[model samples]
Target: MSRSPSIPDRPHRDIDSDLPDDERLEALRGHYEDLVDVNDQLSEQLDDAEDRRERLREKVDRVERENETLKSSSLYIATVEDVLDDQVIVKQHGNNQEVLTDVSSRIGDRIEPGDRVAVNDSFAIQTILNTETDARAQSMEITAKPAVTYADIGGIDEQVREVREAVEQPLAEPELFDEVGIDPPSGVLLYGPPGTGKTMLAKAVANETDATFIKMAGSELVRKFIGEGSRLVRDLFEMARERQPAIIFIDEIDAIASRRTESKTSGDAEVQRTMMQLLSEMDGFEARGEVRIIAATNRFDMLDRAILRPGRFDRLIEVPEPDRDGREQILQIHTRTMNVADGVDFADLADDTDGYSGAEIESLATEAGMFAIRNDRNEVSHQDFTEALEKIEKDDSSDVISSAGYFYQ
Candidate 1:
């Protein structure tokens, strides 16, 4: 800012020297106030210019950072497949193409098989990356224990015992296996008809043990693209290892362990790849510490022989429909809280339901209650039980007839 002339250097020359002394003094005071006002205006302009400079500096810094990011080289994800004396095999993700790259001594000391790493476009290892766990897999971990205990699961007592032996005993007393001079079973495979208490059995085991329970369905493992399924399996096992003494229950395992064929279909190939990864993780050379696997399936015939082998599933528990006695116990359990007349007998009800599953028995009790409500009665009578059984039987027969028309198994 330019300063306009306000007071002359020689005040006497600007004012009249012949004037009285008081008048001269007052004129000088006016000049002094004018200089002070000009100084204040210049200071305000200086502060505004500094503020503008600071904002521009900040904008320049952000642009510089963006430019640096654009100039940086890109990296791709890969994994170390094998390690040798000097050369290591690295497999690029998505493509599964393996390359033998020479690792520097410093990097080779840190790299190991199964470790995720970053590679350049030339497929050379650049840096080791941390293992990433899937959020879905982590969510499967049960924070609160399930409410279903062994006592709550009626019928199928034998199957429950076998599962407990396979899953619980190992975590409770591992030395029992060592004393017997046997490697504890790696997993237990449960096959049964639907609604036969297979899933309930798994929940019971989760309730009994203090281990982390991670439950995921096999259909969730099937992905739309290649390599994703295998990656998910890897992450799941990695999570189990992170939280030791964990139980991984995979329901409807037939979705992934189905019989592998030589067909060239992409879907089949991807599923097979996922199965191979599962097989490797189950009985691989790496030790499986304190982790137990329990898988259930409705279609045992659909499972691949490789997965059903002795090493993978040491114990194959078959959960069949509850026998007469089991059905009676299941009825007593479901009807424990129901208001039933004294004449209603569980033994007779069990006998009447010859092929009904445990689930069906529970449903029968519920339907019996609904019948009482419909009749505007407070207590369920024997007639209500008989009607529920007849209704369920009719529905079952109709379903069989409808299914038989179009499908042959």
Candidate 2:
């Protein structure tokens, strides 16, 4: 241990008796000044020493706390299986060991069956843990509303109407359904070819409503470990139930809800199990209050019949490629923010881009803008659009040729 340097003693007031009176007074004044300076130095040293002692004491306390923490037994997570008069049964996670343990009086009244509790090595309940949704499930929740809106989507008006009636109407106007004495549609399934605004439709719904939106891909539910996928599904639905008036949009749903086969493979079996849990949650014995489901898939035929039933997916809306008018509308919507020259005619462009989906029209508009930029122009022109269409057609033909070559090989 280090010790503080000792402070010097105060200077004594001493003067020669034979000195002149003025000189003696001057000597006494000098002594007084020196004593004052010495006192200030000592005071500074004392303050510094006290500060150092306090810091050291705090450090020692922190170290002692850490040491105690290290010496304490680790707490294990366990679920309360049953609660009796004097004791509670807890099954430890991972080990699956059930132990009947006495609960502390402080938390005895709070402990209940199905509650997750922290227990010590001796199986003594330490504290009750709050129910936690799986982090994976929580991440799927859309905290920020999607920027896409119904106005941004084109060529899917009827499909959008069906979706709103199935999903948004019930959430916004439950009294209407109640007045009619009928239950609202439980879920909506969007099936169509690629790039036909299926996802944008879902996003439009998400943006149009104030309800909680939880979006996830079906591939995310296909877990490698058994029971994990099903647990995740359960957690997702439970979270939706907790956050009522919630909409769950599962994109590419055919990945997990594919037709079940008798393949005896573990991977297939796990996927089937997850699908079964999803089905039960969609239309189970217990009522799913204020929860709506929306799923989209390009391969609609691949989905299982069970998931396509009336109760599970009450509305099956098909979002196909845009017609000429729809394509023109989509083109106009995409280029609304762009600088276009007078020479560009949307009607002509829409006629030229036949069989194009809404997504393709948006891409065409983007490509046209790129062409204008390449030509060092500030505004898109009809010539630019013509060049862009030619390039896209060439690329499409090349892709078809490549596929054909691969198939022949």
Candidate 3:
């Protein structure tokens, strides 16, 4: 509902002597004013056009530079193998081809053995590349401690001790091993069924120790492309070495460390290659300075023998299901902060829950509290624990029956 713009009145001037002199002067002045307004508008439009042209010029320049880069000869990554008098031995990354190249005087003094550098088609050193660690691996280094502590865990006191001795103590007091005239244990491997507190133990170690804790899963090392997985492993270890007093925890380690197979599929081959790289990083020619290793797996039997040798994994700790006494201790630990009735007995509850892991016992305690909450009670009673246990037992039986049915079918 905008109104139509009125047409501008056409300028009129007559030279008749009958017309008033002041009116004629005013008419001329109006025409002059109209021209001035149009000139101002044109000037504004010219300024805008010039600005647009400048922006387009800049955009074109950037694109042209990018095009030049794309059309240029691609450079290859090479490592300095040796530093001779005038020339250096450079080895290409992918094909491992070695060549002797004369370094530019500008870069000759700076170049050294084991430095990564870029090479042109003529094998001339162009620029130095950083020893690249995978960005994902770099992000996995934990600076903040986990809330878990050894006191919070239950039913695996011996396993906790062994882990502390193998990982935490060595990193904290390396002089102990040296003074005793014994090479420190290299690493510890924790194996058990699900919900047996293997991962929690690692978390406890991270919480108690001052070392840089890096945690990763074995499945993360399996990559979609060739050599990518292996590269990631190398970068992870390099990151650990760079940050000494470091602890590396690999969870579900069977994904990469599984037994090497004869099958020649590309995917399987890549996994094995990644595993070999991990093995080399763990027990290569060079010594690991102050890094400690902790790994957890449910299927210990599937891991390759090379990875489980004495130098690689010095201690193999098994975290089993909680026994009767352990169940009581775990139950007590979980329920300490909860509001429970005075008549509740942890020993009686533990006797009822046979073959339950520490995690399951914790869950039972939580479920009992939830039941009391549901019933509008302030404190949990024995009946709540009984109901929770029955529910969990039913679920377990149902799972077993379904699994058996599937196998038969």
Candidate 4:
């Protein structure tokens, strides 16, 4: 029945095959285009996911580095609570771990004070605490300036000039050396009678240059501990090199630098070792940037011969006892604040002092004034100086001459 019904409607004509070539071709092309579009969209989505993963990984890496830095720093903390006297404290969050420290920290100092520090296991932020001694140690590292100055000292003009030229000028005007075509003198030595202003001259150099001044007695460098003294010598030179335009003032250098006797014991050998270290430091290499050494001694002859060699302690200057003019100047300077008789001629007083050093003159002037004050006199007179001189002569035989009657020879 169904076939008959279809035949009744087929009156109009040319029959086509059930599978038409054009229609099938069109359908297959459309299906292939849709698959290609789907693949492209999937590729785009995968690319975006990969980019997001990389970004996350970078953030994790940055956090890891910060956490590691915090763990390594002693001042790291888990929770930031407060800062007290250069100390930082942290309380751990959701964990029993604690950290504490008294060390100072700043922005770039690699410290972390929060739970964000947990990213690094190597360094952990545990707790916060204070070490008063450590705080004090950090505070005490300030370098103090040299206290003595040219104005504070009494005499020694030549010595000051030599230091200014050989040391101060060399540091301040390096171009001058090349311009003048003259190599600066290698070194300057201050040798004099006791209390003749040698040490004062060195201190004045430190003050004039406004340089970092490191002062050490010769005996301090002669440590009983083996190798310690030599090591300190090396450290001192290195520190001076680091702090350029620095002055190293060594007082009583004759104690460690005395004439080298034949070795007697290990102690002597150690002392020689220290001296050798100092020698090497003085002349080891090229012209250093801005470091000058000023050494003082009452006995120049007592220093080791090697120390006086060329290129090392090359200039030997005598800070001698004050002459008449020098004595007058020194007396005048010391008596600036004192009440003195108008007839008290410092010229006559200086003429009476032949072998006195500047220090001796100052002491004498002070003694005279003190005597006047003790007797309730308003002015220091020549007679008071004579009496004071007698009293000092009685006290020490070294002061055997009376002020006016006998001149020291």
* Winner by lDDT: 2
Steric clash pairs (candidate 1): none
Candidates' C-alpha lDDT: 0.77, 0.78, 0.76, 0.65
- Looking at candidate 4, what is the lDDT of residue 366? 87
Q: What TM-score number comes out for model 1?
A: 0.64
lDDT preference between candidates 1 and 4, better one: 1
> Model 4, which residues run further than 4 Å from truth?
1-155, 223-227, 285-288, 397-409
Regions more than 4 Å wrong, model 2: 1-141, 223-227, 285-288, 397-409
How many clashes (backbone N, Cα, C below 3 Å) per candidate? 0, 0, 0, 8
Please list all clashing residue pairs in model 4, or write none if there are none: 71-123, 98-126, 98-127, 99-126, 99-127, 99-128, 100-127, 100-128
Model 3 RMSD in Å is 12.9
- Error of model 4, residue 85, in angstroms: 35
Q: Per-residue lDDT for 250 in model 4?
A: 69
Residue-by-residue lDDT tens digits, candidate 1, 177-202: 87887777788898876677887887
Pick the winner on TM-score between candidates 3 and 4: 3
RMSD of each: 10.1, 11.6, 12.9, 19.0
Residue range with the least summed lDDT across 10 consecutive positions in model 3: 400-409
lDDT of 3 at 337: 97
